[model samples]
Target: MKVVETIKAVRNEVIAAKQTGFSIGFVPTMGYLHEGHVSLIEAARKDHDFVVLSIFVNPLQFGPNEDLDRYPRDFQRDEKIAQKAGVDVIFYPSVHEMYPTNMPMSIHVTSGVDVLCGSSRPGHFDGVATVVMKLLQIVQPNEAYFGQKDAQQLAIIMNMVEAFNVPVNIHGCPTVREEDGLAKSSRNVYLTNEDRAEAPFLYEALKEGANLILSGETRRSVILAELENRLGTGSGRIDYVDVLRYPSLEQSEQLSGKVILAVAYFYKNARLIDNYIVDIQEGEK
Candidate 1:
């Protein structure tokens, strides 16, 4: 219920909770709160004694032509949603609060920036990894929650934790969707009525592609082609349709084990993404 914009204030609350032997859960997000964001908060609250939700719209994670200036913000709405979801603290920091200095070293993402969303948006994941690291350090939570809708970003963060030996645990919660199958996102507001009607096909395409994988179709190129074909039936522009190993995110001609069938599509005004994660056994697929 408490909202604090200063680092000192947030640390004071978290430190006090730590001293009390209460486990901390942190959900870092930009301001707009949807069912997907609520799912992350609920997951954090389910197992942790205290939950801290940070709503800082990070500048580093945005591209020069991206919707940084126009990205949605509704503090009162977000506050109500977080509070209702059992959030204990809302770290509402400003850009200056998070980045006071002029310039400094950033965590340049070397490995996982070559594909998916990262492929088109250069330096995007670097910003994501940096801000996530910053938030993790600031909150010092026992566990942090993120949505699997951003499958590549989630994978990068999970890898960042292991590679850097960060103390906090990164949990990838399921992607919440609408009744019609569109993934929940802040940018969903940008869709026109026509685009909105056509949007659910992206998820359908991903689901169909996942079915191919589950039904003993192991060829990565075949799955990718089928996904693209399915998405091609829609009116939206196809950004990327790929199938890569989960967490590792490496491509394979013959996929084995857990892999994500993901797609990104551009509506007239909005870019939407959805994915299906499936595990393949050695002989089964």
Candidate 2:
């Protein structure tokens, strides 16, 4: 597990790997490694000859009032976990290395950024697309791995790859969750003991939404109502509950094909999100 912090070093090593005909897999992350992150690493290790995990907490993705300053970090602990997950190289670059100067041009995100998380957080996906493009350019891997936990982000990245003709194959792995069904996140640590106890309801609500959709419910408003009702059992503040087409993330009146039941809620100071996707055939219940 070699760790390199400079842009030149990462690019040089990746170029060397390409010259040697080794297939590279990349996993880009904001630090505070958790089981969810490890799942992506493990997937990359399984499919590529070498796996590169970059743990740079991107400043661009964060809004002014967001948790950028307090966003968690423990590089020492993350290094151990990455090595254990069979990561070949850890690209731990500094902010200066990633952004030595202000970005000269903004990566305008046309699609997959006007809804869901993107709707509330303006310029968020632009930041995500820009940083992801930079990292993808630096690594120039044959394949890259991302978790389905950030479904919208995954969709945006996929869109960016297709639109820009980036050569890397993008893979969206399943969302890793706790035994009780809460989706694993680095921010899960912010939950109070009471908040943690109520947090699993986020997943439970999404599951119920999936079940309802699977049982032949097609109305969008009904499903949203049911999901909100299910999540309301907890003492948490509801952020948003939405259902949209998978990958495309467009809104639809009828639920069919692959659809995402996504929800975000605030429990104390912690904001938690969870979702369940259900694919319904043309005529099947």
Candidate 3:
């Protein structure tokens, strides 16, 4: 329940925790606390002696035309939620604290940033990797938690960890969804009443595509066509629907081992993304 806004203060506390032999678990978020975000904090709390949650709305991850200024934030409310989730420290830093004037350097991961969300939003992953690397350096946690709702982002972070040899364990948790199946997102607040009702179809369509693959369909074209058909019924503008390998995220023609069905669409002024992972059993034919 302790809230620290300065990076030096948070870093000092983390250093003290390490000296005391306490393991730290970190959850980095662009603040608009939801069940999905709280779920990440709770998971971190379970495995580590101390849990730190960062609530800075990263400007780097947002494009110039994107909703960075209007992105939802309520730190007072977020603090309460974090405390309830057993969070030990809430690292709420200002933009200047995270990125000083003339911050020239940035981190980039080349493996999974060329397609899907990355393809649509140029320079998005660079911002993500940069901020994440900075946060990891500041907190120096033993582990970090991210939701599978952002499958590609998770993959990119994991790739960065491996390639850079950062000594932190990156854990991808399951996507938390509403009862009707819409993947919970902070931007869900931007949807209209009608848009909210129709939004769940994104997840439904992904589930259907996964089921089709499980039912012995291997043709990527046919599966993607079916997914598009289902998502087309929703009110949002469909961005993309793709099926690819698990961590590699390359397009796949056959359902062999681990496959992911991912989609992104725009509802109202908000763009949302979701994905599902399925294990394709061998010898099903």
What overall lDDT goes with each candidate model? 0.91, 0.89, 0.89
Q: What local lDDT score does residue 49 receive in model 1, on the 0 to 100 scale?
A: 95
Candidate 3, residue 39: lDDT: 90
Q: By TM-score, highest first, what's the ranking?
A: 1, 2, 3
Compared with the true structure, the alpha-carbon lDDT of candidate 2 equals 0.89
Number of the top TM-score candidate = 1
Q: Write the per-residue lDDT of candidate 3 for residues 1-285, one digit (tens) a residue.
A: 789999999998899888999999999999889999989998999999999999988888889988899998898899889999999999999998887785677885677777789988899999999999999999999999999999999999999999999999999999999999999999999888888888888888888888898988878888889998998877678888898887899886765688888999987778989998887875211
lDDT of 2 by residue, 164-243 (tens): 99999999988999999889999999999989987888888888888888888988889999987887788988777899
Which residue pairs show collisions in model 1? none
Q: Determine which window of 10 residues in candidate 3 has minimal summed lDDT.
A: 276-285
> Per-residue lDDT for 113 in model 1?
75
Model 3, position 55, has a per-residue lDDT of 92
Ten-residue region with minimum lDDT total, candidate 2: 276-285
Which one wins on lDDT?
1
Predictions: Cα RMSD each: 1.6, 1.7, 2.0
